[model samples]
Structure formats: C-alpha cells, structure tokens
Target: MTWKTLIVRVTDSCDGTCYGCLWRKNRISGFTLPVTTINDIVSKMKDFSFDESVILCPNPLYNPKISDIILSLKKVARKIYFFIPVNSLSKVRNKRIMESIDELVIVTTTPEDFKVNEENLKIILSQGFTNIALYVAIGSHTINMDNILSLVNMGKEYGLRIRVGEIPYSTALTLDIKSILAKKGYSVGFTYGMLYGYMASMAFIGNYPVTILAKPLTGECRKLFIDPYGRVSKCPLQTSYLRVDKVTSDILRSLIFSECSIGCRRFELIPKIEISLLTPDGKEIPSEVLSLLEVISHVNSLRAACSIMGFSPSTCVEKIRKVEKEVGIKLLISKKGGKEKGATVLTDEARRILEMYREIRDMVSESLYSEKGIMRFKLG
Candidate 1:
C-alpha cells in the first residue's frame, strides 16, 4: 500500500521551551534544513512519484528560509501544512508563507492559549489564511473534559477548527469527550482499532470540524518523515533513519521498507469505490438518495432517517423529489398523521432499485480487489 502522508522537519529549532521536549532532553542544537537539501529531497520525492500531502513539523517558522522551503516543497506536494506553536505566530511576517500553505496548524497546550493569542489569531485569519486549526497536545499535560469544552467554545467563537491528539493514555477522557459532545446535540462518529486499541472520533460544531485521535500502539506506519539530517523513515518517533544519498530506485525502495517486516498484516489497505446511478435521460442519482432510502426502509420515518444521516428533513425530501421527477417514478410513500404519528416507507420500485444498486456496488468492489486491480493502489 502507498503512504498517504509525508512529514518534513524544516528546522529542529524553536524559541519556546515546553515540557517533555526531546530536543532539549537530547541537547540537540538548533539547525535549519538548507534550501539545497530541501531541493534535493523534493527531487528525490518527485523521482519516487511521491504526490501525497507534506507536513512541515515541530516549528517551521523558526527556519530563516521558511518561505523558500515552502515554495520548494510545494513543487512535489499535493498540499503543504505548516505546524507551529502559538508563540511562533509572530514570525509570520509576510504574505509569501500565507499565500502558499494550504493550512496553518497551530499547536496549543492549554485552553487559556486561545485568550492569550486572541489578537494574533485575528490577524492571521484576516490575512487570507482560510484553513487554519488548533492542535491541542493532550500529551503535554493532564487535560480534562472542561478544558476540551473550553477550547471548543473558543474555537466556535473565533471561527477556528480544533483537534485533540495523544489521547491513548486516557480512555476515560476519550469517553467523556464523546459523551459530552453527544449530549450537547453534536453528532459524533467514533471508531477504535481492534488490534492496537486506537481511538479516533470526529464531530462538527457549527462549520468547524472537531477531531480526536489516540495514537495506535503498533500498526503499519503510513507516514514518511525526513529529519534535518536528510535521512528518511516511516515512523516520526523513530530515533534512527536511513540516508538517501542520490541512490538508485531499487536501493531507495529497499531502504524505505527496511524497518517494516515482510508480509506484515497489522493494517491492510482497501479500495474505495463511489457508486452512481444514471437515468435513461442521463440524469445522475446521487449516492445520498440511495442512503436515505435505505435508512427509511428500516426507520419508517423520513425525519428519523434524516437525523441519522445528518441531513435536514426538508433538504432530504427535496433531494428525493428531484430524483423522482427525473427518473419519472415515486421512490417514497408518505402517510399523514391522524391519532397516530405520520410514517414513511420506500415503494416497491425503490426497493428494486436499492437491490440493483447493491448488486452493482458489490461487483465493482470484487473487481477492484482482484490482483490486477490492486496494482492501482501500489506506490511506485
């Protein structure tokens, strides 16, 4: 399977001295990744056909040539995410970095940080950076639900997106966060890894999306990190790395997977297929319509189906009506309430359509999982 993320430490330097710092703990001196080294890495990535998203981690703002570094990395990256501390916002002095990066990921350790950097946050938001977020490092301190809620409320107020990470140490905190968000009318989608006990959950407060992740104990590393010394490794926390010194393609591929075992089945990659149906006249039926029909088939109420699917009742009905008008067939049957409540159900034709759609979807999935089809997802 192909790796989906590439992380580069543009500089191993930072002005702030936070707790649990590996840099200070190891006494590693401040160093900036040179523009020449960055160009070399980008060329190697291009040669390897690495087109995934790149994340400049630790504190890229401390690097003097950050603007040039971002421009060089952008040549091979699908998108560039710059990670910096809340105090490093002052180093963002020009529009060069602002105009290039796809997202500005700000690292904050506590809830009071939102108030401390209120003016700076306003300035950055006003300067044309549309996709910015706050990464709360739960590993840095003993955080509770109140702290998380406070951050969420401030995020809503400032129109900022938020994510909480490093939560594997506390199962109670994870449950509490999900429970509180659910009780407050926020819809949460949660899942945990069976083998490693990794917890990940997602929800949205207004327009901003909230994410929480508990790092897996052991799994297939889908991320490649390039440290300041020009060495590469899949895991970010790995201490040693393999150096790529203008090597051949075969040698480089070997070096990339040298740490990972052969035929390791910790995590498996699967193909994703989008199922779409078209009418005879060429009108496309959205996948949402199929999902709504399926939900209504079980719930027997349009309102209940919409609630489960995160859609407004009126919006869902309008979508179904459009499809029905185009296909020239009624998809749903509605009954008005008398002494009992109103009810809804799919028509016979709708059931047939659902079945046909499922058959087609399964066939497509089976085809894509074949040996020939699996080649498309392999990394070069």
Candidate 2:
C-alpha cells in the first residue's frame, strides 16, 4: 500500500511538562529541523505517494521557523496537520501560517487543560479557524467522569472533532469513556484502520466525530515518520531506520517488512495473510520462500536478500531447492560472488508464480473491505 500519511517532526523543543512525553525522552541535540531539510524530505516523499503531512512537535510554537515549516510542507501535501498545545494557542503570532494548516490538533491532558482549551478554541474560531480537533490524552489513573462528560458536551456544543487517546499501557479509562459514550446513544464503532499505531473507536456527536484511540498496535505499518534530522522510520515512536538521502524504491520496499518497536508490550494486533499452496508431492511452498524470492528479485543479490529475510545462505538455498522440486520448475538463477555481492534473478516460471500469488493476495485483501473502503476487520 502507498503511504497514506507522512509525519514530520519539525521541532522537539517543548516547555510543557506533560507526563510521559515521548519527545522529552528521545529528543536530539538539534532542536528543530531546518527549512532546507523540510524541502529535501518533501522532495523524497513525492516519490512515494502520500495524501497528508502531519507537522509534529511537542509544542510547534517553540520552533523559530514554525511558519516556514508549515508553508514548506503546504506545497507538497494535500492536507497539512499541525500539532499545537491547547494553552499555547495565544502564542500564535503569524495568522497567515494558520491559513496553511488544514487541521489544528490541540493537545490537552486533564480537565483543567480542557477548560483552557475551550477558551482557546473560541479564540481560534473567532479568527476563522474552524478545522480544529481536541486531542485528549488519558492516563491509567482514575479520572473524573463528570469532567470527562463536560468535555464531551463542550465538543458537542462546538461541533468540534474530539480524539481521546489512551496513554501507553492503559485501557480501562478509554473503555470507560467508550462505555459512557455508547450508552448515551452516541454512534460508536471501530475506526476503519489504525491511525499512526493506535487502534481507535469512533463516536459521532451530532455532525462531528469523536475518535477514541486505544494503545498502539503492532504490524502492517501504514505511516512513515521523518525525524528532525531527516531520518526515516515506519512509526514516530520507534528509532530511525534509514536516512532521506537519495531514497529509492528499494528503500521504501524494505520498510514493508521492517519491524518497529512498540512502547507498550502487553498487547499486539497484526493483520496478516495466510496462503496455502499444495504441490504434487503433498508439499507446500513456504511464505518465507516467496518473500525471499521477491527480495532477491528486487536487490539482485542472494546474500543481501538472505540478510534482509534473516535466512542463512545454506538454509535459503535448501528452501528454494525444496520448493523447486515440489513445483517442478527452476525458481532462481544465481551467480556466486563475494559475501554480499552476487547476481541473483528469478526465472520466467518463478515470476509467473509470484505474480499470480500477489494478484490473489491483493484480491483477498480487497474482499475484506466494505463498499465504502473501510476494512471490515474480524477477530477470532
């Protein structure tokens, strides 16, 4: 799948002492990304299609070039999302920059923050900024239900989008909020798919939708994160895996199988495809063999493909030979060389088989989606 969203960390300098802030824990020496770096990242992103760009910073107002950052990203993305602390709304000096923002994500924590956020929302609305969302981060401790309901009512009054995100390793608070909202006849259902890494449930309040995001889930990465230093990763919360220098299709394809580390280790939700192909001798072709074959076709090196697939050379050869014997066809043609350099290519029969498998796989995937294009996820 093409990358649907690109998250760019424009800055890491933050004044707020929000509990368990990821920026504070993983911030680098370079506080903000320069305009030149932003342009470079945007150019690289054009190679792989992305619908929207999210401007990330613990507090975007702290960046000196915040205006330029937003303007630069506006040229590429169809929509630009800016994250700003709710209390810092008054700090926005450049009204023109706000025009470039397609959505304003106002981060709030407690009831007190929401109180301030309500006033802040009014201020922005007066300035003609209507595309706004209130992002509420809830912790594991017991919360005041009255205040939470008050926040909900306020959202309903203003017709604003509300997103309640579960802080890492917490579930009960969001579940309680979901239960409360569901009981009130609010339209609540699971979101089409994961956002960032969080699996969310949506609740509609009048015309606006309130999304409650559960803790981060693993597998099937759909988001690409670019840090302040122009390094790339599959998720914002993980370590940078590659740089943005001369990014090719190979680099992007490699991320498809890249594993990202999750902060919460308790639960995992990964969507996968199980394929069963029986040969004449009652043998089945392993999925890993197909993946290895595909990687070899792309990189043109057996050793490099083996390293990427985490397979020993001898083991990969044995698997390939087994599949070849089962299918009665030559799957791979290899020319031996150094440890990491060699010519490896797929045979005509192998390409046909891989193409057929991929077509069936994509067909099955599309079958799992609704007519509106939302994935109809099932659990067993």
Candidate 3:
C-alpha cells in the first residue's frame, strides 16, 4: 500500500541544541544527505498521495539545497513540514525556507522556552503558516507547570497547537491539569518503548489517547526514514537500520519482524484487487469492465463514475456491452435520478464474481505472510 506520509531526513545540523534529546543523543557531527539519495526518495514517493504533509526531519533550514529538494516532490506532496527550531532570538535568514514550510514545529527543552521564544514564534507565524506547534522536552530541571500553562495559552491566542514530549511529570499534576490544559490546546506525547515500559505510558500520558497514537511504536513499516548516510529505518526509534542501496522485497519483508512492537498488532493491512474473467467459450472479459464496475459500485452515477475514470459515456456503455457478450449475462442495472443524480449497480452474477475474486486475492497475502513474521505479526 502507498503511504500517505513520508518523513525524509534532510540534515543533522541544528542551530540550537536541547538537553532532552531522545533521537539525537551522541550525534554531534553535522551531515547532509546526498542529492542523489534525496532524488531517489522523491522518485519512489511519486505514487503515494501525501495529504497530511511530507515531514523533513532533524532540520532542513540548515541545508543549503532545501528548496531544490522540496521542488522535486512538489508535484506529489501537498504540503512540506520542517522541524524548524526557535530560540529567544529566533529569526529565519532564508525567506524562501520560511515561506515553503507548511508546518513549523519548535521543540523546546524547558517550559520557560515557550515564553523565551515568543517573539521568534511570532516571526514564524507571520509567514502565513497556520500549523505552528510548540513541543516541550522535559530535561533534568523541573519546570513549574503554572508558567507553562500561561505560555500554552499565549500560543493558543495566536492559534498555535502545543505538544509536550516524554517528560515524566507528576501523575497527580498531569491528572489535575490534563483536561484543563486540553481545552486550551495541549497535546502530551508519551514514549512507550523497551526503554520505557507501558505502565509509564498508561500513567502520565494515559489521559490523552492521542499520545499512544502519536508514538512511533504503532508503525506500519510504510515510511522510508533515510539518514544522512543513506541508511533506511522504518521507525525513527530504530538503531538497526538497513542501507538504502540494499533495499528490496526480501529486506522489506524482514522488517515485518523488527524488534520494535514485538507483540503489538497495529500494522494496517489493506487489500486491493485486479482480476480478469474468462467465459467457457474462451472469450476474455477485459479489465476496463471491472475497473468501471468498481468505480460505479462506490459512486451512484454511471456518468459521474465514467468522468472520474476519464471514460466517456458511450465508451463505457460499449465496454459494458462487450463484457456482457463475452460473459453472456447482464452485469449492471441503471436507473434514473435516485438519492444521487443517476444510479448504477452490479447485477447479482457480477456481485458473486467480485466477491470470489476478492476472497482469492486476500488469500494471496495470507499465503505469503502466514509463515514469516516480525515477532507475532504474520509476514509470510
């Protein structure tokens, strides 16, 4: 299945360093991904439709060729997000970078950072970007939630969505303020990995179900996370990643059993079918008949369905006739305006055939992944 979201690592350079770095620990060297690798990712993602946004991770503002990389995916991606950092004196020198970015997520180390970067945050929001988020990274120092409460409100006044990440706040304090803060626009992100047990997840961040959903542990292995060295990791938390050059079906299937999410079965499984029908006389029923039937099944109007698939009314009817002649059965029932402007439906025989084909197509995946596994997940 094609992924709706793609997170590509553009650079490892950051203007400011935070204390509570979960991903960037021990990573000091500044690095940029090769242009060829970037092009390869852009080329591969041409099939998927990214409605959420293409997340350029670590940092993209430091990259000199950020615009060139973004331009390559502009055709396929609807929006581009950058983890652009902001400090007290935050100012983006490149206007193009600021303008091109659809989402600007400023992750803060301490609660005080929210107020400290208020002016810089304004500069970022003024660039016509509506999706501004402030993430709190809990460090060694304990922060008074009172100040954070006010800062979060201030951000909300300017329409900024705030996120608090991985901080072990008092369960009592989070319980006391969870609903109060949520009403004013607050999202707490909790971590659930081998490092931190699930008990911790259910305690502090359990008040918000979104915290569990946001965690990378619920991965589908759909994202291709490429590091500066062209190493590919499905989950951002993974340390053992495959090289970009050696990517193949065998390699991808192997990841279905990765160490992360050893027992969790949250991977999404979507089935798609493309089948051809044959008559006893050896007459072939073309693919366009099923393609048109599939479209008409969802949409009520035959004319609208034809328009959506770039098929003219006459051509669609002609194809339907040809298929009917080969199959020796009427496959569609047409009607005048009903709930929709016009209507069409697959006949009883057509429904039986479609169900049989879909069941067989689903068996293909089961046969492939039933034996192979990524832990408890079947990956045969």
Candidate 4:
C-alpha cells in the first residue's frame, strides 16, 4: 500500500504574497477567512484506519492565532511539519516554533538567498531543531551552478540537509531544475501547479519512493483531506467531499466495503445462449439432436465449435450431419469467402433450440437473484 500525506491549508489567506500560488486562484470571496476548527480537523483525521502524517501550512508567520492551531494539531496528528518560505522582508523568528516541529522546511527562490538561508539555518540549529530541510525554488531566472554548490557547501557546514523543488508555472525551469538536482543526487518535490497529477502518477509507476508530502489518502487505506471550513475533500486539489462535517469510522468503513455501482460498456457484447429443442412452429426435436443444434448456435460454424471443444473440425461436421439427418432439418447456414472472410450462421432449426435454452438460463438467474441478494452476485 502507498503511504498518503495530507496538507491542510489552515488559513484562507496568506500574509505575504507569493507570485504563483494555486490557492489564490480558488480563494473563497474576499481577503481573510476563519481557520478550520480543531475539533472538525481531528474528526476527519480519525476516519482513516491506517497511519498517515499531516502537514499544516498557514499563510505566513504573521498570523498570531496560528500558534494556537499548531498546538491543537500537535495533540491529534501522528506527525506534523511546517513549510516556512523566506522572502526579503519577513525572516525566521521565534525559535520556540522551530523546536516544536518534527521537520522545519525553508523555501527559497534565488541563489542570493543561499546566504540568508544559511543564516536562518543557524537560527533553527541554535534553537536545537535537529531535522531541518531547505528548498530552493528554480524559477524563470537562470540558476547558476556556483550558487547551488554554495548552498550545498553551506548545508554541509551547518549540518543541514537540502532539497531542490521546481518553481510552479514554468515547465522549462522544472525540467532544468530536475536535471540539475538529478545530477546532484537529489530529486525535486512538486508543490502546486500544472501536471501535478501526471508527476505523482509517474512517481508511483517509476517506484521513486519519495514521499508526496501533502496528498489525500485512498484505496484500502483511508487517508483523506479536510478543508479549513471542516469540509472533507479527497485531496487538497479537489473541493468535493467524500463526506462532510463528520468523517466517522462507520462512514469510512461503509465507503470501503461498498462495491462500485458504475457499469462497464463491455456488457453489451455478451451474447445470449439457450438449452432446449422446440421450434417456434411447435414442432418438437429429439433431445440428442437438439444438443448438437445447440452447439451450432454457440459457434455457427462446425470448425469454430471444433476449435472450442478441442475436437477435429471434420468430426464436428459429421456430428452436425448426423443430427440434421435425424432431425430432418438444416442446422448450418454456410457462407463462401471473398473480400469479406468466410463465416457461418445457425439455421432457423438451430436458433429455435438456442431460444429455448436461453429461457432456461433466464429462469435459473431469476431464481438465484430472488434467493440471494443482488449485491452477493457480481454485476456485469
């Protein structure tokens, strides 16, 4: 089973504006919105049977109420991490917050921030936060190898680990960043942007083994996402809910056990079959002769029946001739090959036998359906 992670956007708004933020596109109405209540969040998390980590991402450090929410989350979350992006103005402060996290992530845009990031790294280290990771966003600007080398060297100096992630909205930059990181023995993590699903699918199929930090849990394992308003979503990217307001253990189990009602188009190709021998004209044929006629209905050609039954085509032809001679009626409608390939059809005599057999099959199915529930049988 695949491990799932949930990233909950605690606030509807952010303090500092980032250039390419996907959440900004889906903003509710105006500026600020109330954060999701702790009770609702915990209730949603408990619906799942399997273990999962939850990451909380608030707008910025400027929100005074964020600390209270973080404290509440720490109580319920199996594991928690913070993503703090550093820009020119607001820097890292409050060592207490850093110490509280399992992992502290710093997001940077440029090589110039390498020095500032290194300085911030010192502050996190000074606070005694051991698990610190850095992310450098390679955007439209040309990234110099020297700057990456400088950041790598700085990470070594501070005993901090570094990870590179592609900037959202730039395909060229994403490819370039991935190539550079691949050369350096690091893989880029995807945040919000185009082709996110494709990237995630590729990661799973390729067996990359890297953690997708904030995705909804699914399959036999019941991982999921909860919005700030307490609405549960399959993933943060989707706004629809598998369930809302209350995600109980019973509700989750019901969803897991329920079979998919969605039907497939292939059911239309299944041909009907029958098992008796009376003609539509009310003429009765012998049971032994009818059995041979029934085989012709299934495979119109003697050759086809022979292939299916693992008997010689000539033997099947002789059996058909013998049955027709006994019944005193035609059983095969032969067609000659030309541009269209040669084929055969069951004669009227054979079709009558098939219709009777189909009636018997339908009766049996109806009995089973009445005795046992439809849910007990697999739907085609």
Candidate 5:
C-alpha cells in the first residue's frame, strides 16, 4: 500500500531560545529558504501519490506566514492534518483555520496545557468542528502521571480522541506498560519507525483515537516527512538531522521499502553459510574448523576476512592453498585477478559451507522471534 506523505513547514526562523527544544542546540545559521520552495513542494506532492498528507508546522504561531503557506497546500492536498502546540492553539482563529481542510492535531507537551487544550477543544467543538485530535508528548525527564491521567480523562469527557506520543529520542515505556495502557483505553502514538534508532510505544485508550505504532502498515509503503526547504526527512522528529535534497516521492518510497527488504534479505542469506563441516554421508561435520567458522561469521567480504584473520591478500592465498592441500579439495580463494580487475566469488565448496552456516543462523533467529509468549504487533 502507498504510505501517507507529510509536508513539514520547517523554515521557521527560531532565535535559538526554547528550553527542552532539541533543535535549539543544533540550530543552523543562514538556513532560510525562498517562498517558491513551498510551491515546488506542493507541485511535488501533487505528482506524488499517497494515501494521506499532513502539514506539520511545529510552531506555526512563531511564523505568521504559516497560514499562507498552508493555504497553498490546501490546493494540492485533499485532506491535510495540522499539528500545533497547545500554547499556540489559542492564537489560532479556529473558525477561519478549520474551514481549510480535514483534521486539527493539537499537541500538548505539559499537563498545564491540558486546560488550555480543553478550552480550545470546546471552542472548536462548539463551532461544529469534528475532526480534532490531541497529541501528548510524554517526556522521560519530567512527565507527570497525574497530568497524563488528567489529559486522558479530559479527552474522554469531551469525547475527543487523544494520541499519546513520547518525546524525541526516548525509549522509556516497556511493551508490557504499553499493552496495559492500551487495554485501559489510551491511544499511544509511538515514534518507533522514526529514522533514528529510538523506539516508542502507542496505545489506544479510546474508540476513535489515532494510533501510530512502530511497524509500517501492511502492503503500504512507509511515510516520509519532507521539510519546506526541500529536504526529505523520514520522520518529523528527525527533520532537523535527516536532510536529503533532490528527493522525489519515488525515492522516498524506495528508501523505506529498501530498509525493510535489506533486513529480511540479510536474515534469509544467513542460512547459506556452513555452520559445521559434514561428512560425505551428511553426518555432522567435525568442529576442528569451528575457529574458522567463527572467523567467517565476522567476515562480510574477502577484505574483512583478511583483516580479521590478520592476513594480507598474499597470506590469505597461501592459507587457502594450505587448506586445499590438507583437505584434498580445491579451496576457493574469493579474490581473482582478471582483465576486469580483481573480483570475488565463492567456490562451490565455499558456497556449500556458507549455505550450511546460514541455515543454522536462520534457525537461531527464528527461535528468538518465535519464542513463547513473544507478542507480535500491528499498528494503524
């Protein structure tokens, strides 16, 4: 399935001031972009096929031009989701803004913002605005359970959907806690699939809340966040760091699928290595070459093997020659000198050994993922 696309308005020229803001530390100077870039982005999105799209302006209030920028996006996007912090929610004219498109995703970083969020929600609801969602950022350093409960209760009372998200670069919540919270009726929005390695959990506490989980949707390509400055990022939280220009929707789609495919392919190739030598009758091969097996396990290529074995190219060739002499079979030296230059290929014997090793590796990996009571997850 095609993944959703997000056009992020990241050109806000913040003066490097906000506390707890990750971007404050790595702020780049002279990074402003022309307004025409937004037009280019809109043109690209129109050509880019996707299931849905969102306009992510982290602090839209800080930039008055955001409304104009979003107005341009409304022309290209059928449904646009907005995520604005609670502090800036009040400054927004709900009536004029809600008419632009589909959903308003209000984000709250602290419990104090809950009251303000509630007040804003009521105003929006009273105005007959229905497509509204709340995003709560649960920080590891200063998150208060009392505040979380209050926000959840408030969301429940108002019949508004709540999505709980963890702070950037945090993995504090355990799966058990996530499962328990999910059972208790809170919608968790994890940033697990973010570009960086940080993992987060998402649980649904209500019937209609948005749930963002770690895994990508089946049959669908993964989503990517493209910043206003023409930088294509994999996630909103990673917008500052992951900047890839000269990006199209197709390249973004490939990037996501390639990541998943590479992981699966690696696992599949593991069974092709020889775990142990076997007799001619297919009996267990002796463990005499176990040290070599260990060495091979760490070797990704001939160069790597040579490095690990503390052998130069010439030494490696001599070692292979010695092994062939002892085993009475031709040993495959991965490197070959040819007119096309040096090339690497596994000999038939080497291939057999590699295949056996891979089989054993696959067995071990399968055992781990399929361990008793391990929970497989799906996200919407």
Candidate 6:
C-alpha cells in the first residue's frame, strides 16, 4: 500500500515553551537527527511515494539542517508541511522554511494576538509564504464571534486556508464553522483537501484531550511518528513499545495498511489543548518557569528537575527564586542534609500553585466545547 502522509519529528529542540505541551519540557536543549540516519530512512522508501505530503511537526527552526532535510523528503513526498509557532519564528528560519516547504500550518493563539495589530503580520506575509493555514485550539473558554472572525480574516488576507481544531465533543463534527470559515473574505479560493488531510493525519498521532486511549488494535497504523532519536512509533503520542529501531520502506508501508480501527461506532476525537498562565495581577508568567516548577514538584528535588529540563541547578534556583520574589510566595522548602540526606520539598503554597496551574490546563482542555458552539474556543 502507498502511504499518503508521514509525520516526522526531525528535532526535539525547541527554543520556547508552548505552555500546554509536555514534549518540549523534557528535551529543550538540542538534539538533531544525524544526516546519515535521515538519509538512510529516505533511501529505504524507494518502493513507494507519498501522494499527500510529509509533515515536519512542531518546529523545524531548531534543526539547523532543516532545509536539507526538506530537500531529502521532497524526493519521496509530493509536498512538505511545517508547524510554525508565532513567537518562535525568526526571519532566517522562515526564509529557509518557505523556500523548502510547500505549505505551512501557522500554529498561533487567536485571543493573544487579536489586538496586537497586523503590522508584524503584514511585514511577515510580505516576505511571501505560500499555501499557509492557521491552526487554533478550542481550549476551556467560549470564544466570541468577533474574535473568531478576526482569526478567519487573518487567514483570508494572506490567501491561506484556516483550520479550527479541538477534540471532537460532538460525535459528528459537522463543518458548521467551516461554512463560516469557507466564506471568502478577500482571498483566492483553495480546496479542503489541504486543510482536512493535514488536520486528520496530524491529529491522529498527537497528544491532546488525554481522554481517548484507543491504541491501534492492529499491528500498525496508517501514519508513523519518527522522532529525533530515529525511533518510529505507531502513534504520535509514542507510548508503550510500538517503536521500532529500524524504519524501512516495508516498515512504513506496513504501517499504512495496518488494518487498524478503534472498533467503535465512532472514534472519540482528542482535542488539542493549549494553556497560558498569568498572575492574579494579569502578569503572564513564562510557561517554561511553570514547567520547571511542575518537574520539581514531581521529583521533589530542585537539582534533579533542573537536570531534566537541561538547565543547571543554579540556573533553576535563580529562576524559581526570582518567581518566588515576584509572586511573594515561596514555592520550595530546602533541607540542608549530610551527604544523601538533603532534599527539597514543595511548600503547601507551592502545591496550591501547582494545583491551580493544573486547573488552568484542564480548563483549557475542557474548553474544547462551550454553550456557544463545539467548533471554537476562547481562553480567558
């Protein structure tokens, strides 16, 4: 069987925190797949071709050699797509990506950038990116119609497709919002295949909602997730041992025709969640800091948590202490110990803070639907 799409995680090195994502929390420093490994995987796919495309998930910017990776995948894939973050974009990276990629799914926050004015966006779009799309998650709050139109207009101005995503609350995810989205504002017309095909394949392997636990009952899945370590997993979430050391043409082909299904009248859609944290005073705390705090809470050791995020113990100390001062709350209690007796524990206040953070996250996840509608989310 011929595979139409493949999800490749070229690198796990992200420069920023996405707030809702746990993948970037652990591997933020740097790690790129060696060219040899990538080349081997590409050469192995000699027997088949991708009619759709190969999606470079998350951020391709962190991979120094992403342009070359695109070139290699081009031989096997009809097109290439990238998931670009709003804040994480740089001119050089954008230029390189646009040159090599056929389409781009610009992952951005609708509420955050609503009033920011399109000056920067105007300048960036002027640089000329082709076949762009906007991806917004329906988190825990109800989005008003005005903001929804604003997001659609942005995509229209750029002559790009727009996709509004969430874990499916309704069994039949009718394209009701698509009708509103499909109405042209001021751009040329494009087909649904670009947006829907991309959305389906990408969502299939992603982590969100955390509700649906249906693993591929068959030996494989139609799509594959290739990570930076060159491991191939059956699902994008990549849990358990559905991973293989070697990925060949047969391996990828086997995945596409794996005869896998959830064995249900309908499969539950796992909503893609996004969360942002701010102080009661409305000052936004960097998600990276919150992630650090979360790690410390679980491990009960400041140094170990720092190590997990690839940060030095002292650096972590400075970050946490600075937040403590700013928030006027001590998050961690230190224990001076002899040799192995020393440990760090979260204060009661810190535990409360963590619980609150989790509440915000779960709220965003639940924001997948509201009374207004099932298709859009607005975060407060």
Sum up the clashes in candidate 2. 0
Better of 1 and 3 by TM-score: 1
Candidate 6 overall lDDT versus native: 0.52
Q: Write the per-residue lDDT of candidate 5 for residues 73-154, one digit (tens) a residue.
A: 6665545667666665566674666777566766665666667456756777888876666655554445455666677767
Clashing pairs in 2: none
The regions of model 3 sitting more than 4 angstroms off are 1-3, 22-27, 51-57, 88-91, 126-129, 138-144, 167-213, 216-221, 248-380
lDDT over C-alpha atoms for residue 124 of model 1: 77
Which stretches of model 5 miss by more than 4 angstroms?
A: 13-34, 116-118, 141-145, 168-177, 182-221, 237-380
* Reference-based lDDT, residue 160, model 1: 57
Q: Quote the lDDT for 11 in model 1.
A: 72
Shift in Å, residue 111, candidate 6 = 3.2
| Alpha-carbon RMSD, each predicted model | 11.9, 17.7, 14.3, 24.6, 20.8, 22.5
Per-residue lDDT value at 37 in model 2: 74
Tens digits of per-residue lDDT, candidate 4, 75-169, equal 55544556665541235566666666555655555556556445556665676666655544444456565655565565546644454444422
How many clashes in each candidate?
Answer: 0, 0, 5, 5, 26, 4
- For candidate 1, the per-residue lDDT at 282 reads 92
Per-residue accuracy of model 3 over 1-380 as CA lDDT, tens digit each: 32344456677765555555533424646787776766665555555454334444355655677777776656555656556545523645566665676556665664455666777766756766555555554444354466455545665567454554433211211122332333333332122211111111111121212121122234433443566677777544456777766776455434533444332324433222235667778877655566566556655557755543434589799988988876789988876666643468888888886666545533543432233421234233
Top lDDT: which candidate number?
Answer: 2
Show pairs that collide, candidate 6.
Answer: 139-367, 140-364, 140-367, 167-271
Arrange candidates, best lDDT first. Answer: 2, 1, 6, 3, 5, 4
308 in model 5: Cα distance from truth in Å?
A: 55
Please provide TM-scores, in order, for all candidate models, with all chains considered together.
0.60, 0.59, 0.50, 0.46, 0.52, 0.52
Give the least accurate 10-residue stretch of model 2, judged by summed lDDT.
371-380
lDDT of 2 by residue, 125-237 (tens): 88877667666665545545565566666765775567776542223222335544544555444333344345554445553446666543444445667776667777666
Checking candidate 4 for backbone clashes, the offending pairs are 217-223, 274-357, 274-358, 275-357, 276-357
Q: Which of the two, 3 or 4, has more TM-score? A: 3
Clashes of 1: 0
State the lDDT of candidate 6 residue by residue for 155-187, as single tens digits: 555544445554211112223232232232211
Cand. 2 TM to true fold: 0.59
Higher-ranked by lDDT: 3 or 4: 3
